[model samples]
Target: MTEQVVTGGGRRGASSAVERVVATVREGVKTGRYVPGQRLVEADLMRELGVGRNALREALSRLRSDGFVQIEAHRGASIRRLTREDVAQLYELREVLEGLAARLAAQRIGETDHRQRLVAALESMHEVARTAELPAYMDENIRFHRTIVELSAHPRLEELVDQLQIQTFRIQFRSAAANHDRTGMREYSVTEHQSLAEAILDGDGTRAEDLMRRHLRHTRSGIMQLPDGDFA
Candidate 1:
């Protein structure tokens, strides 16, 4: 009985450790501490995340599957970086998927609180953008998009978009960084997001879809303008 209990406890401990390491590493990526193409040293990550080597390794393996990290023999792990083609291809898919998501969400959003949630998220983003809080603005921007996806009421669509969003997060950060006039950029974002929220709220599916496509196109243009070396 004691041996069985010990084995179960060990499994639970490892599970918890894996969860912790995953969350820590994901947050680090989102917050830009682990920038695109940055090498991840196992020893430093183990110390930082307070996990054993085995658990940390397992967590890094999961991140690799999630497309946030790449692992290779001899080189270990590093954050995944995007090429110009990657940016183009990703945005192309996002425009289609996100536009469809918006249309579906406009049709189904009344079934839940997602509409109000989207409005609140946009308001929060506007407030933070005014203050020049890029991180907070990005957080709210993510929340706003997530709410729209949730309102689509399509599990498979949500899953796919979630994965894409994770991969494109660094691109979004770089796009924001490339802006020379942050105040103007923030104002533009607020205006665009407000219009998006309004279209969804009105249940104008066609308009919502078009607006979403336009918004994504604008972002794609900005990302493409970034120099090649910016990705690294």
Candidate 2:
């Protein structure tokens, strides 16, 4: 993504038509832009986004596979709803997979451009958070977490982590912005990301692994405690 673009809706970078639709829908799910179990209107979106029907269908299919959309037998695509059980299971898997990814990424990252890329991503998220631009914060959040997973050396781990991270975004975005008190969560995330980067740069696999595990545990707890809706 280039420099951040501020849309009338909010701050999001420029992307392709289908990608733009996917992201708009995803954030809608995240920030209550769309409510749970809300049905998508292809005609409406096509008009709003200036895309054809095929592009909208493709985006919905992709999102359904990613666990963000659910298509009923007779009812078209609607945003997926997370039951209490669904949230618990997702958080459990996320805790384990993400911790492992971070540790593994730290095993291979050197002290150069790749590490710098992650730091930049984390800082960008921080800036968006400070500015109260939730969508940009969410975008950068995905990028920063993916940077760690991509460096982890195992392709399978990377894929699994990516899936869990999507679920994480769905939950957290549905919740609210991290509060001032939870600034600790933000600082801890940024600081650990920096430390993990250094660990990989140094090729200290053991430390990287341990830190990643701890980081995931912390994240799971922090996220769960944050105020979800009355139902959550």
Cα RMSD to native, each candidate? 2.6, 8.9
TM-score of each: 0.85, 0.66
Candidate 2: Cα lDDT at 52: 71
lDDT of 2 by residue, 127-157 (tens): 7667755556657667777787776667998
lDDT values, one for every candidate = 0.84, 0.68
- Candidate 1 local lDDT, 91-185, one digit each (tens): 88888999999999889868858767777777777777877577677777777888888889999999778777767777787788779897788
Residue pairs with clashing backbones, model 1: none
**Model 1, position 10: C-alpha lDDT score:** 99
Candidate 1 ranges beyond 4 A from true positions: 1-9
Clashes of each: 0, 0
Q: What TM-score should be assigned to candidate 2?
A: 0.66
